[model samples]
Target chain A: MITIAVDAMGGDHAPVPEVSGAVQAASTQDVNILLVGKEQVLQAELKKFDGWKKLPIRIVNATEVVTMEDNPAKALRTKRDSSMRVAARLVRDGEAQGWISAGNTGAVMAISKTVLGMIPGVDRPALAQAFPTIKGKPAVLVDVGANVDSSAQMLAQFAVMGEIYSRLVFHTESPSVGILSIGEEDHKGNELTKSAASLMKALPLNFVGNVEGRDLYTGLTDVIVCDGFIGNVALKVSEGLVDVIKHMLKESLESTIASKIGYVLSRQAFKDFRKRMDYSEYGGAPLLGVKGVVIICHGRSNDNAIRNAIRVATESATEHVNDRIEIEIQRWQASSTNDPEV
Target chain B: MITIAVDAMGGDHAPVPEVSGAVQAASTQDVNILLVGKEQVLQAELKKFDGWKKLPIRIVNATEVVTMEDNPAKALRTKRDSSMRVAARLVRDGEAQGWISAGNTGAVMAISKTVLGMIPGVDRPALAQAFPTIKGKPAVLVDVGANVDSSAQMLAQFAVMGEIYSRLVFHTESPSVGILSIGEEDHKGNELTKSAASLMKALPLNFVGNVEGRDLYTGLTDVIVCDGFIGNVALKVSEGLVDVIKHMLKESLESTIASKIGYVLSRQAFKDFRKRMDYSEYGGAPLLGVKGVVIICHGRSNDNAIRNAIRVATESATEHVNDRIEIEIQRWQASSTNDPEV
Candidate 1:
């Protein structure tokens, strides 16, 4: 069975959701989970669930917790035995195949990188987020809030990583990658995207030129690459707009008696729609280009999100995604060195 | 009477929506409309609308038309007598108080800036888009695809211009301005936003520091400023997400007979919701920092959008928004030079 480490002292309401999610995953999936946190708090939470003792879940003691307010560098240096750090250590020490956290994102990234190290030939790791497209399949958007002020070469690397993730995880035959920009034309982006476009075009992958923001949901490309700043803004803006739309729909459906009855009758259809758009269904975003499998969930993720994240981590680990990434990175570096066009 | 010029040969479906919208605006509002386009085409379209001859609308002949595929620079130099250029010339020659176009965005910006000139002390003009906020008030987002690769000083100028636009056009008192970034912390942005933040802080405007993409619709700040590339992507992404949500809602409502019935019952409420979210209601985004009032509409705009653009252009002209923008820009420039913090 694949072993996964869960940071139980992370997240907004830690220990409870983390333990509950581990129990659910261990009970259903063929996996073992180590809940890293204060042993007593995790044990107390586990007692509330029936048959959790029979599940392949265990408590791993952690002496400290990293608060949300703590800076990433400070948390990495100071909180040596924090739950997040302990989780990363478990993966590094071969105690677990993968690690999952729902904590301060920067702290989780820093600790995971410091402990697990970087895959050879990779300059920086990226966060690859899966977005549900209009064509009923998920697409990967890479470098979503991982590093800022990235260079053209970094963006080109992200495109390759995102393409591989789409092919392996999403099961695309051959993923087509596009760089996000203001327009779909070749000459239409800021300086970063413009230079990145040239670099990406010369790569061995299927590089479809530039794409605009409207194409994000169009499913025209299997993978989209952008800098962390633009990618993060796009992600958050989509979330905000979706919330406002849902709010508007709710207000309209409850405004009158007829509409209220209609809403009740059509509740199942709405439920299905909600499930399709729910972020928790996709689990967590994977930190690519890292030496080990590390999945990072939102700070406010719930039990369902955590359980799904574990499932994703198990699949990623079992597939040996990191090994494949290292192979691809080495091949890319060789091609760039030999290709006269580059 | 306040006279407004309409580019009758612009938009995806030229002359039809323009002439119809001009007739509606002239009949309803206390304004005169100049339809600038091919004389014969304008006459043919005007003939389809009954009683248009009795309205305060006149057709101005233009010998050329700028197609969508034409480059902005090329169109400016070659198509000097095009409908868009003729309309801008009308505004510049004191025959019209303002001008409205639903043509190519780049072409419109190029022609308007060349014809009307720039407000003193303003380096580059910006496009300020008004968005409906959760608090039921509109917030202005500036530099929406005007200039890319902007400097820190230019961003500071955008903040000042956006502040003036919000206060004058939206009628917000002492508007609060914020810089768009990845995080809300003062130190959470890229190099561009970081340097821009310091410059904005030294200005005399009510600077609220940094805001994230989620704050775009929260009504927390009256104005949000960003570089054109980021601003354009944010605007387009919001639009794309809204379209997807609406599509999902429609698909769900049609999945079952019960939902179909519910949709019928809730049709009025849904209509109200649609009206509130409709882009036509808010009209075109005003191009601020220009010497004259200019409103640029979407290429796919309908009759209602054109009519509303006319209304907005009239209001902007009546308020002397350009003069106000000039005064505030001069004040910001003076303060930036004298402030020690800068």
Candidate 2:
């Protein structure tokens, strides 16, 4: 059975949700789970479940905990025995096929990259998240917050990784990749996007031309790639705007009795809308380009989010996504070196 | 009476909406209007409106028009007698206090900047748009598409311009200004935002620290400043996402007969929601840092949007916003020079 390590002391509501989610995943999915945290705390939390003794779940103890306020670099260097660090170590030692955490994102990235190391020929790991599109499908956005400042080559690498992930996860035969920019014209956009577009065109994948910000929700392309800074800003801004629209709609609907009745009738539609927009439905973003699978969830993730993240980690490991990424990167490198003009 | 020039031969449905909007503004507002376009074409369009001759609207003859596809700089140079150019000339020749255009944004900006020139101490002009916030108010986002690659100093200038516009337009006593970044922390951002934050702190304004993308709708700050590239991307992304959400809601609601009845009952509430979200309600974005008041509306703007744009131009010119911006820039410059550390 494929094994996964999870940080049990991470996220806003930890230990309880983490333990419950692990138990749920282990019971439903064909995977063994190693819950990494304080043994006493985790054991107590896990005992509350009815059939906890039957699942393929075990506890791994770690003395330290990394708080959200701790500097990521400093925490990675100092908190050697932290739950997040121990989970990463388990992946490195081959005891677990992948690791999942909803803790401090920066600390998780630093520790996971440092412990499991980078896949050969990959410059840096990128965070890829799925956003629902108008086509009733989800699109993958890469480098959401992993690399703030990225080169054209790095963006090209993101395109490759995003394409592979979209195909494997979404089951698309040939995913169309687009470089995010302010305008659709080839000549438009800042220096980075323009250069990235040229490099992406040289790849073996199906590369659509430059796409504007509007294309994100239009589902004009299956995979959208950009630097971490812009991707992070776009993702957060979309989240905030959605909240604002919902608030305004609620306020407007409550202004009159007729509208209130209308809201009750359309309540089912709103429920469906919320479910589709919910972040937990997509689980967590996978940190691609690492040697081993590492899924990072939002810090405010709940029990459902944790369970879904575990599900994502298991799927990624079972699919052998990392092996495919290595093969793609090697092919891209070989092509680039063979053609001097590229 | 204040006078505003209109580009009558611009936008998707030119001369009809343009002429009708001018007549509507002239009759309702206390302003004289100069409609610039081909004399015969505008006269034919104006003839359809009753009491058009009684309004304080005058027609000026122009031989050419600037299409949306034309290169901005080239059009500015070659289309000397175009309607957009003639409107800018009216402002320069002291015939009108300001100009409004629902034409090509880049062409309008180029012509306005070249003809009217920059206010003293201002490096570049910025485009400012008001976005509805959750607080039932609006926040101004500056440099929406003016400068793609802005320096730290230019971003500081945008903050000053945005602050003044927020105080005058939104009527806030002391508008809180924020530099848009990926994170709320001072140390978390790309090179540009980091450097811009340090410079903004030196200015004598109510400067809030760095804000995240989520802060845009939270109404955490009255004015959000960033390079045009990022701001443009953020603005378009918001607009596109809103459309997608609305489309999804409509699709979801129409799936059932009960929901269809609910939609009819809540139709008024949806109308109210759309009115609140409509860009036309905010009139047009002002091209701040320019010597003359120049407002740019969307190319697809209707008569209501055009009319509101004329209203905005009148208010800006009457309030002498250009003078206030000059004064604020001088004050900031004086403070910066006096403080050696800054």
Candidate 3:
């Protein structure tokens, strides 16, 4: 049975959404949840459920909770008994298959690396968030908010991992990979992107040349790998743009009755767009290159988001992706090292 | 007189808009236009103009043109007689107070640095773009598509330049500066942003820690600094979002009578929003931290954009922003170097 650990004290709607989402996940599958947090608080929340105790849901009490303001390193160093830390410790000790946290992002990353460690041969773990394309297929954007200042080699490594993850999850045999750049031209971008593009060109994959930010919505590439800084900026900027447009649409629609009817007729498509952009439904971002399946949920996750995170974790654990990533990276490194162009 | 060199053979619309824009700019009392391109073509376009060429418009002959597809460095080297190249050279040779090109951006940047050289103590120049906020104020986004993979020091330098530019150009004193990051929390973001935030904290400027992408529209910060890769991505994504929404709104309004009425009444507000977000009005991005003033306009610019670019260049040159930037950066560097925290 797939085992999942949940940080019950995390998120904006902590305990309530966490317990409900976990219980909901447990009821649907033969999965055991080690709910790490205060037993009194969780037990109080749990009693509100309708016989959820029969669904293999158990509470593992911990005295401490890591506040959002807590320094990630210091919290991991000192809060040896906190729910977030202990939950990660369980995954590290092999008691749990995957760990999920909707706590502070820094805390989640810090605890995971300190406890679970990086996958062998993986330089640093990357955060990969999946965005649904116009085609309804997911495009994996790696290092969205992880490692910055990555070398060209690391970028190539991200491409391999992104390809594997996209293929396994989205079931695409030949996923097109792209590097983000200012211009579509070969010699358009700065040194890092140019060098990374060259490296991607030499790779044994369906490597498309540079794609601009406009290509993200066009669904031109299956996987987009960028440095965490750029990736995060792109992700956040895209999200903000969506919000702005949505607001504009609302303001425009409410101004007229005919437009409102038009909006109603097109409601299905608008809802489809909203669902396509929804991160909660896709679950948490996976910390790629981690030894175990470490999913980083949003700090403001609700019941549905947490459940989705658990579902993603279970699927990834079953696939044994870490094993495949290890072999792929090694094979790629060896193959590319012997080649002159690389 | 503020003498500005305009590359007439540059943009997609070439001399048509370039000549018209120069004629328009010449209408301003303090402006003189040195129209740089093939004399015959420029004069032909100038003749079609509605009576203003006799003012201070002069034609400079340039035999060649730089296409967007050509390699920037290679084209700059080979096309020494190109209108774009001569315009840059004129700025370097101090024959013009400033240079404006709505042509090949890559060639412009490469040629500008090669011809004019960098201002002393400035490592790399930044392409800062001015954006209008919903609050009716403007925010200067630095490194818009320049200096990709920029370091914390480079970003810090951008913050300084952006501050001075915003103050002198937009007339905002002690404008709030924000480093774009994934999370608004102080501890979030990649190494570059985190380091830059720390460096910004130590500067004399009013640094407003971290900002999310949505904060841009809300007018939460006056200046935003990020690497060119991210900046460019944000620019394109935001532009695409706006376009998509505008198309949807127009489609919705065309379908019904009530919607038509609503559209008519809300037309002013919608126009205001459109005008605020319209990037073309800003003319072009200034090549900041360069010794001489240079503005890189959009490759697809028309006459109005070219004219606006010339006006922008004239204002920047008249303000002596390049010289002011040197003193500001040097003083900031000198003062912050010996801080006790350092």
Candidate 4:
């Protein structure tokens, strides 16, 4: 059975949604669940469940909870017994196959790295998010805010991990990967993208060359890679724009009665569309290239987000994604190291 | 009266929107118009209006037309007789106070640099687009695909230009300017933003320090600046996300009849909000740090966009934004070279 460890006292919604989500996952999935948090708070919430006693759910006691506002490094040190740190340790110690957290992002990255260590040949761990494209296909965007100043080699590793992630999760055969560049031209983009693209173009994987920002949701390629800096800016800008437009459209359609009839005829497709666009339904981003699986959920995650994150964690463990990644890295090591493509 | 030169042969809509927009501007404002294109075509389009003989409109003879698909550099070189090229010449020769094009962006920038030249002490020109903020304020984001690889000095110039643009167009006093960084901490971000932030912080302008991508449209800062690679991605991704959300929302509101009624009650305010979020309503991006006013309209601009571009071009020239930018750059150069702020 797959065992998933979750940080119970994480995210803005706190123990309520976190514990409830774990309970829901327990009722549905056959995975053994461990929720790490203060026993009193978590148990009190769990008691609200209808049939929790029959499920494969367990609780691990932790002395402290990590606040979203706390500094990542300081919190990891000062609150060594915190739920987030303990949950990460569970994965590291092999008590659980994967760890999930909606807590401090920096702390999760720090703790996950400290405990599990980087994969054999990977430079740094990357956060990989799966975006459903216009073609209704899953495309993985890597290093969405992990490594700020990544080398060409690091980007190549991200592409490798992204390819594997897309293959395992969405079951794509050698997913097409593209490095984000200013222009699609080979000679275009900054020093970093140009160098990285040249190296990526030579990889054995299905490297489709440079893709622009608009191509992220276009589904023309399966993997989109960039350094954390550009990727973070692009992600946040896209999120903010989405929020603004949602607010704008909600305001616009309600203006007149005739338009209201126009809206009624399109409701079913619209609900399905909204459900498709919801990030929570896709669960948290996985910190790939690590020895153990760690899913980092958004701070504003709801009960559904927590549930999906657990589901993601369970699926990753079953697929043995980390083992596959290690094998891929080893297979690529000698060529990547001795040849140093680029 | 403001003399705004119109490149009648420019843009996808061509002489129809261009001529109609000129008539609209002339009807709406007391500005002198010099329409530069093939005289016969422009006259035929213009003769469709009654009482056109009394308006302060004049047509300049030009035989060539620059197609949207033409190479920017090649068009500027071979199409010296094109309407777009001649319009730039008019601005260069001081016959027109400003020039506006709803045609090819590359061609506009190319011919403008060839004719008008960049302002003294300015490193290079930067493009700034005004995004609507939460409070109806417009935040200017610079380097939206002008120069991909920017030096620290170039970014500092963008700050100065952004300040003047915000003050003259956006009407913000001192215009709190921010360098887009990965994090809010002083030591955060990649090399470019960190160095540019140091330069910006040392300047005399009201530098509010580094801001993240989330703060771009929150009215947190009057001006937001970044390298073209990051800036272009942010703008395009934001536009794509906006479209996605709008499409989703139109679908969602119609899902329920009661929600449709609620939307109807909120229609007018929503329209106002939608209008506020649109970038096209703000006319076009100015090629800042140039000697003369040059407005680069969207390639797909309609008559309304052409009209707005004329308005913005008129306003910028009247306020001497180009001269102010030169003065600011000169002051920044003198202060740095002599006093050495850093």
Candidates in order: C-alpha RMSD to true structure: 1.3, 1.5, 4.0, 3.0
Question: Where is model 4 chain A poorest over a 10-residue stretch in terms of lDDT?
Answer: A260-269
lDDT of 2 at A319: 85
Candidate 4: Cα lDDT at B95: 92
**lDDT of residue B313 for candidate 4:** 92
| Chain A TM-score from candidate 2 | 0.97
True-vs-predicted CA distance for residue B200, candidate 1, Å? 1.3
Regarding lDDT, does 1 or 4 come out ahead? Answer: 1
Task: State the weakest 10-residue window (summed lDDT) of model 3 chain A.
Answer: A264-273
Per-residue lDDT over A1-342 for candidate 2, one digit per residue giving the tens place of the 0 to 100 score: 899999998777787778888988898889999999999999889889988888999999998888888899999999999999999999999999999998999999999889999988899899999888898788899989999879999999999998888898777789999988877779888888889999998889899878788789998799999889889888999999998889999999989999999999999988888877787778799999999999998888877888888888988898888999999999889978898786
Summing lDDT over every window of 10 consecutive residues in candidate 1 chain B, give the lowest-scoring window.
B333-342
Q: Could you tell which candidate, 1 or 2, scores higher by lDDT?
A: 2
Error of 1 at B264 (Å): 1.3
- lDDT string for model 4 (B300-340, tens) is 77778788888889999989998898887888788778974
Query: What is the interface root-mean-square deviation of candidate 4?
Result: 4.7
TM-score of 2: 0.97
TM-score winner: 1
Residue-level lDDT tens digits of model 2 in B1-342: 999999998898997888988989998999999999999999999999998999999999999999989889999999999999999999999999999999989899999999999999999999999888888688999989888879999999999999988888678789999988888889999999999999888888899978788889888799999889888888888988999999999988898888888899999999999988888888889999988999998888889999999988998888788999999899889877897876
**Candidate 4: stretches off by over 4 Å:** A251-273, A336-342, B250-274
Clashing pairs in 4: A254-B263, A254-B264, A255-B267, B11-B103
Winner on TM-score (1 vs 2): 1
What DockQ does each prediction reach against the true complex? 0.76, 0.83, 0.29, 0.37
